[model samples]
Target: MSATATDTKTLLGIALASGGYACFALQDALVKWLVETYEVPQILFMRSLVIVLITGTLAAHFRHPSILTSKYRGTLVLRAALMLFAWLLFYNSAKVMGLAELTTLYFSAPIMVVFLSILFLKEKVGAGRWLACFGGFAGMVIAANPTHSPNLIPALMCIIAGFFWACSTILIRLVSKTETTLTQMWATSLLFGIACAVTFPWIWKTPDLMGWALMIGLGLIATIGQYLLYEGFRHAPASALAPVEYTGLVWAFIYGYLIWADIPASNVFVGAFIIVASSLVLVAWERRSIRLAEKAAPI
Candidate 1:
């Protein structure tokens, strides 16, 4: 590639990652708001339908349906089912716990992922990472004190959602070598949408005009956000952009404060700091280990 083209790609990559953050932040905020005024089932179904439509249209226009390869069919299917359940947990948590609490609790998933990796993947984790995992649990305790509060249930739901998040991540990583990202995205979302559809009869509730708007807005923003995430990976390495995911916590805090009149406890803030710090440490360590391995490799 030409120097100018290379520079353009770099810029696009930065913008894509940043844009992904903005769009997802907005999507989460909107969902939090809409859940209060409408049924979770209605909102989720609409969001799923609209997101699938937008994604499907984009996939078609790109003329790269092959990107959705048929490999990893089983893993992709399982991941999709897990994701649908995760979203349901997410919506319930958002509705009850609002944003700040939910955000802090949900991020504790990384700690779980670390332990699960030890069990399932048999990955080598040093003492430092183990300490960091403990620190994350301490943070969670701070974020979710055992008070007879309405949000306690939601906080626990977020914790459960985190496990599913870890599972989905593991599935994706395990299958990534066998399938293309595009194929995975389409297949996962298709299955997820279908799963969401299966719940329609039980939880369906009539929605208002605002609910409709929020649903479409969520679908569009989330689709755009996910697309930007993919574009970022295309332009730059994952290591450079992975840290940016933490920014969602900031957005969650802001949304909670501005939109929902929800203020986090002192413990929540402190715990969130610990949780995010541990995650960054883990990611940085993993990257260093990878580079060291590459350097030690034979030509």
Candidate 2:
């Protein structure tokens, strides 16, 4: 592709990524609202039901009947389980914490992914990236500011959720080498749906009209967000999309302020900036490493 064409595609990818993250922020807000009245299991059950129906319909229409099947069934189940646990913690945290603070802390997933790659994949990490990783952790601490926030447990939950999320990301990368995107989506929905079902009878509460609307809207929004995210990767490399995902912080702030009148502490902004800078630096380093490796490869 020409340089101009590449630029256009990159821009499209950024737009799609931004839109996807925006949807995610909205979904988080909805979950936060719903959790005030409904059980997490009920919310997850309803949302996963929508995901299964939507993904199933798409797979059948595309005539990819095998999208529900995966060679890496074990890996897929593990990934889904990790994600389910992560969401459980994350949603609970969202109910108690400021959206921006929680999101900034969760954004550490990429940093955790880097460390996970070094440890599990045996990938080499440079000094600069190591510094960046430490810096990202420091930023999380600064954002959390345990002294100021009396309830530290929610922040801790977000941090743990981010770690599980990073693990899921690594698993997804490994599985994606052989499995289709649809397969991964189907597996996640199926496994999460089953999990929610197992717990539904104990926590089930009938929803009013607004509650039903929120539940259905949550499912639709999240599924559409995942589709847009998939489209983004198709248009550009992940390195290019990484920065765009940060726009989610902006969305979180806006929604938090408008809906809940939550104004983030100054330290939260400073810490978020540090974390974002560290992540961007890591992305640049990774891109350069890839380019250097390609140049050194023998034809």
Candidate 3:
């Protein structure tokens, strides 16, 4: 690609990624709104259906040949299942939590990813990394205390979401090791769509105009967010892009406070700061470890 084209692509990728995060924040707010409008299962069903529609349309238009018939079938199914649980719990948390509180707990996923890599992939992580993980969880517990103005139940829900999210990440890593990202995404969408379709009828309800708007918006924005995330990672290394994901927290806090009138208690901010600090520690630790490994390798 020409230099101009490369620069254009880079700028476009950043815009897409940032837009994705904004959409994700908006989707969470909409889900919070829908907690009163419709059941979580209903929302999940509609959300998955929307992704399926959008992705399926893209598949047809692009004539992408390989999908679930790829090498990562097991990983795809597991990831889809885990992420479904994560989203369900996340929506429930949003119902009872401030965006920031939920976000703090959600941040635990990267730390969890570190430990999981050590165990499953046998990636060698060190003591500092372990300490970073402990610190992240500590922040979560501190944030959940009664003194915190943010409700405890939602924080707990967020913790649950974090666990599942981590599991989903592990599954993604396993799949990515063996299959194309696009194919993995396709398989995941298929499995999630099936899972949601199965549970949809139990919690299903016909939405009114506001509910319809919320669900559709939730679906569309979520799809865009997922796409942007993939595109961003495709263009830049995670070491660089990882920090940018933190911006989502800022967006979440902004939307929660300004749009939803969510005034976080003092404890929420304290806990969030700790969590953010821990994440930075983990990032630094990971980068250093990668550098050491690179130095040890033969050039």
lDDT of 3 by residue, 31-63 (tens): 777888687877877787787787777776777
Off by over 4 Å in 3: 1-22, 93-107, 124-160, 231-247, 266-299
lDDT of 2 at 195: 91
Residue-wise C-alpha lDDT for candidate 2, range 1-299, written one tens digit per residue: 54445545655765776688899889888988999899998899899889889888777677764733667888888889999999999888877886547766787776677777666656555765676566666666676565445258998999899999778766755675566566567668888988988986689999999999999999999898877866665565444454455556657767888999988799868877876786566556545655665566567
Q: Judge candidate 1 against the unseen true structure and give its global Cα lDDT, from 0 to 1.
A: 0.65
Model 1, span 152-242: residue lDDT tens: 6777788888889777755655665455455566666677667667777887777778767778888878777866765665664333333
Cα RMSD of predicted structure 3: 6.0
Models 1 onward score TM values of 0.70, 0.75, 0.70
State each model's CA lDDT, in order: 0.65, 0.74, 0.66
Question: Model 3: which residue pairs collide?
Answer: none
- TM-score sort, best first: 2, 3, 1
lDDT, candidate 2, equals 0.74
Once fitted onto the true fold, the runs of candidate 2 whose alpha carbons sit more than 4 angstroms away are: 1-18, 65-69, 93-107, 121-145, 148-157, 230-247, 268-299
- Candidate 3: deviation at residue 114, Å? 1.1
Q: Ten consecutive residues with minimal summed lDDT in candidate 2?
A: 236-245
Q: How do these models rank on lDDT, best leading?
A: 2, 3, 1
